[model samples]
Target: MTQPLLPDVRRPANGGPKAAARNRAALIVAAREIYAAQGLDAPLSAIARRAGVGQGVLYRHFPDRDALATAVLEENVRQIEQAAAAEDMSFADILGVLTWHLKESAAFLGLLHMRGSVDHSEALAHALALSDRVERALRERLPDGHRLGAANDLMLAVAMVSGAAGGPEREARERRAMAAWRLLGVEVGTVRPFDA
Candidate 1:
């Protein structure tokens, strides 16, 4: 069956009415992929195409690029929260989850760096708060003497990973992330063989 061009734009903003929520979720998923692949300057039309929706439907949910970017960050924050809250997750696991997110969402994280210019103040605040929560959880999981340093190093790791340019710098980025873990005195290649 052929997909609809756009979500039924007639739905409400709460994303409550099933169809609207589905469209919103699809747009978010598409936006993440598009932004990461094409950079933040990518046209909204491209995002709409990727989401298999019309531009109007995309606008209905995210009035502007910043709005869509905000949604992406919001989702990233949610993922981090879930990882941090996982009871079975160890410190290394949490760090790995966060590091992987940083690598995957490097472009979106760049949007976070453009704090003042973007109209995503609320979203930025939410992301920052979530990051703090992740760091706090990691700190709590750290061995007694390593807590503070580990937390500090994790933050540094985020900066390093987020600042990296993809493609040629991909290896460098991975190295820097692992190096930050090493800075925390966490043994790399033990919990995960990330020696690459």
Candidate 2:
């Protein structure tokens, strides 16, 4: 007899709606880890294996890589929104959260640059809206002479960090991000540490 694709221990016998939800959640967590360690181009099969689900289950949940990527980005946005909601989180703190996400997730920078795609647009919109709020807060905190040159300067700063975070080496990436922060006139000491 042929062996089942998923071990009996991994999948409940009923395999009902709850199982589907569990499989989807597992796939997202697995993809996030795999992508962070191996970049966005990591094979879908690896994600399936890591999630302990069959490839068909993965395809059912995410028809394509962009779909999966959008889901991951949405989760990241949710975390950022949560962090932003903290009463004491300063504008610099928000930037730190954004920078941390970009540095930690290989898929993040690539997906953020995919501006025209409808699949990822909603998550991107939420992230940009969060950035807008941060920019407003920053404006309030800065003196007239230190104000940003344009409405999108915060976005530019984020792009710089995202670009720097994609460097070949981790230490180099951190150094480059710091340099970009300094060039943008953001005080590195004011921003929260990127670890975690």
Please, what is the TM-score per model? 0.67, 0.66
> Lowest-lDDT window of 10 residues in candidate 1?
187-196
User: lDDT per prediction?
Assistant: 0.64, 0.68
- Give the TM-score comparing model 2 with the true structure, all chains together: 0.66
lDDT tens per residue, model 1, 17-58? 787888898998888777766677889999999998899999
Q: Any runs in candidate 1 off by more than 4 Å, and if so which?
A: 1-16, 111-134, 147-151, 164-196
Error of 1 at 128 (Å): 4.1
- Report lDDT (Cα) of residue 124, candidate 2: 70
Every candidate's CA RMSD: 7.9, 6.0
